[model samples]
Target: IAQRAMEPWAGLMRSFRAHRDHVWCKLSGMVTEAGWRHWKSQDLQPYVDAVLSIFGPSRCLFGSDWPVCLVAADYQSVKRALDDCLSGLTEEERSQILGASAIEAYRLPL
Candidate 1:
């Protein structure tokens, strides 16, 4: 399971290096560890950096787990937390994080 899971990360690194354009990447969701139910806090920044470092600010997106996030935080709180985490990024990047990335990825109408 570990090996299978890592393949996509490897592939993304390779692709990011190869393509100069932006790529939308999704991190693995909340994990199970030490009987504590929480998202991987430390891993978040580095992963965000990896994506931003490779694809720049325009390509990144934030996801609130919605009903899943509700397991620990309400939807509004989740949204606020995402906003706080992404506060350092540009407005354009923030826009991408909020919804633009999804529309672009799925080829939805703007």
Candidate 2:
């Protein structure tokens, strides 16, 4: 159902959904979204996979919400959780998600 709904708008939705050259931020808030107490890296994998599928590694960036993420886990825990979710990716792909994508997406100077 959700997939169907997104198909039609997929192209235009690139602004946030990640299509073509558009990028996406795979950031904090997963723990709360997955239920804080029971949240695990596995619980976030499906979502992470979906974003990676939609955006591809070259168009995805990692972001941290800092104090907001503190509601569920410390900064290190959040980083670990995202790292675990992305553990299966190739080193280059991981590099893209970790920083390269942001640099390209925002056209930031080196």
Candidate 3:
């Protein structure tokens, strides 16, 4: 399994959380690690939980991974997977992952 497999990074995520003010995590480019043809939203939940648990919604942003992700999943599927993974969170947290975090991270001119 590659580094993207998510299990090994739980500890790293914890370590990284110490720098949460200076670090950000983009929830993208991971679906293929669950396997291109067989991946399901359930397979994605643990990874999402890890990040949200470690970084919280304010430190995360959704990423489509675009043409690269096309190797395993499409744009809508990627979004839906994140939505499923985020189901237990409050609406504001979900919104943070979907858009606001990116805006804050990049200091977007919105």
Q: For all the candidates, what are their Cα RMSDs to the real structure? A: 5.0, 4.6, 2.1
TM-score of 1: 0.58
Task: Give the alpha carbon lDDT tens digit for every residue of 1-110 in model 3.
Answer: 13346655788889877865688999998776768877888888888888888888888999998988888899999889889989999999999888999998899997
In the range 1-110, model 1's lDDT, one tens digit per residue, is: 21224347746686766775545664323222111245434424454556666665556566666566555556665566456556688888888867787788778985
Error of 2 at 91 (Å): 0.3
List lDDT for all candidates, in order: 0.56, 0.73, 0.85
Clashes of 1: 0
For candidate 3, the 10 contiguous residues with the lowest summed lDDT are 1-10
Model 2, residue 69: distance off in Å is 0.5
- When sorted by lDDT, best at the front, the candidate numbers are 3, 2, 1
lDDT of 1 at 66: 59
Off by over 4 Å in 1: 1-23, 27-46
> In angstroms, what RMSD does candidate 1 have relative to the true structure?
5.0
| Two-way lDDT contest, 1 vs 3, winner | 3
